[model samples]
Target: MISTRLASLLFCSLVLLACSSKPNQDYDTGYDFSQLHTFSGITTASNSDPLSAQRIADAIQSSLLTQGFKQADDTAQFKVNYTFNITDKPKKSGLSIGLGTGNWGSSGGVGIGTSVGVPIGNDSAKLQTIQIDMIDIKTQQLIWRGSDNFSFDTGGEDKAQLTQQTVAKILAQFPPQESLK
Candidate 1:
């Protein structure tokens, strides 16, 4: 009987896991530039997750290279940098209700409460924003900038996959207008 119960529980767990949805890919990659050449190295502002920062930077660099931008040496046609910020908010799990009368009739009552499972205070880690900027190396003026704000669950393997996908999607917006069909 115990084994049967355990098997049932395991089946339910796997079903729930399978039913869970993957993170939605939401990003905006709007740029005004028509054409561009080799891109220089990328720089990142101080980030809580240095590994994440590097991963993002590398992903963008690789995407740029695939787009025909040669990694430059002495000078770059454009320079890039990114900033990431994370925020947390408390989450509530259940609801609360008051029940009248205790066993002693001492005017005391039993209060039942349950959490809503929704963030109530700064409790859940959320990726607030990911901002990337590109500048004209010669003029040192801002050429392109993109910022995306989205919520994500952290410290999971899915987070890393999402990051890579987000970076790639964002960089895909570079060089702006696409070739006419």
Candidate 2:
């Protein structure tokens, strides 16, 4: 009865916690993003998952093309870099307290297994950060950046589609709108 309700509430809370955070964008305020024409090299973070990274890169390139940008052969105006970071954040489970008087002595201890962290997909939930940076070729400096934070499972289904969709969401903040910068 009461335990069932508590379990349901906990499950709902975990789902909410694993929800996606909106994409964020930042750029050098002094930089004029509109002046940029073509870009190249969406090099990914070292040791990042290759297949997933490819999906992300393709989506980003497609999005940039749609934004009226082109791929360059050499000395492109800007260089793009991307990275995916995943961290295992252990959930803080609750401990139950018990107090009573026993025949031998006073019995008081914390009961274990009072709470358990909810799982995501087929495995544990993880905190995921996806970042994309745009660097000025001539200056060799970062001019614009976009990122997104979310909780998800590494073993999720349709991983390719997930990567594509996430890339779309992150790149939607790209080019650093003038007013936003």
Candidate 3:
């Protein structure tokens, strides 16, 4: 019973340790513009899974259009592309200890206490980052971009919902609205 409790605790600790840290946003402030117009022929950085890339790109484009941007197929103002990079890091397990106390009595009477030691196990997981970039078609300089990090889970029916959430987050910085003075 003690060993089973220890194993459960260890498993929970390792699961918490595998979560990835958040990524920071790096944007260029010099190119601040009130309105952004889309460019023709929006392209994607080569991805291992073209179908997945298309799904993500389509979602992103839809979000941008809803935000009042026009999509161009010819010469346009801005070009969009997305890239993803995955990395794995090692994680160490967590250890915990418990203590118990007991008492002894004379006249052949005695009391006992219990203690437990939890030994956690080490594990590894990949940290996936999706970077969406918007570039000025004329100058070829990156005007705006957002990178987000997520821990990948293979089996989930919420992928489409999650993708929509990610798209909304990334485009929240777009249009570059200025503060009222």
Per-prediction TM-score to the true structure, in the order listed: 0.58, 0.65, 0.61
Model with the higher lDDT, candidate 2 or 3? 2
Q: How far in Å is the alpha carbon of 120 misplaced in model 2?
A: 8.8
Q: Give the clashing pairs for model 2.
A: none
Model 2 over residues 43-146: C-alpha lDDT tens digits?
88665566666766887898788878899949589989988887886544445432222232553332224344554444445766778899999999999888
**Over the stretch 1-181, how does candidate 1's per-residue lDDT look in tens digits?**
4554565567657867985533222222443354457678788867688877877787778878888888884657778888877676444455543222233444433334444445554566566456778887777877676665555666567766776677666666665544211
Give the distance in Å from residue 156's predicted Cα in candidate 3 to where it truly belongs: 5.7
Q: lDDT (0-100) at residue 41 of candidate 3?
A: 55
Lowest summed lDDT over 10 consecutive residues: which window, candidate 2?
96-105
Task: Put down candidate 3 lDDT per residue, 71-156, tens digits, no spaces.
Answer: 88685788888886656755534554443333346322223334454424535655556678888877889987777765544424
After superposition on all CA atoms, how large is the RMSD of candidate 2?
A: 10.0
Evaluated at residue 95, the lDDT of candidate 1 is: 58
Roughly what TM-score does model 1 have, to 2 decimal places?
0.58
Model 2 TM-score? 0.65
- What alpha-carbon RMSD in Å does predicted model 1 have with respect to the real structure? 12.5
Worst 10 residues of 1 by lDDT: 23-32
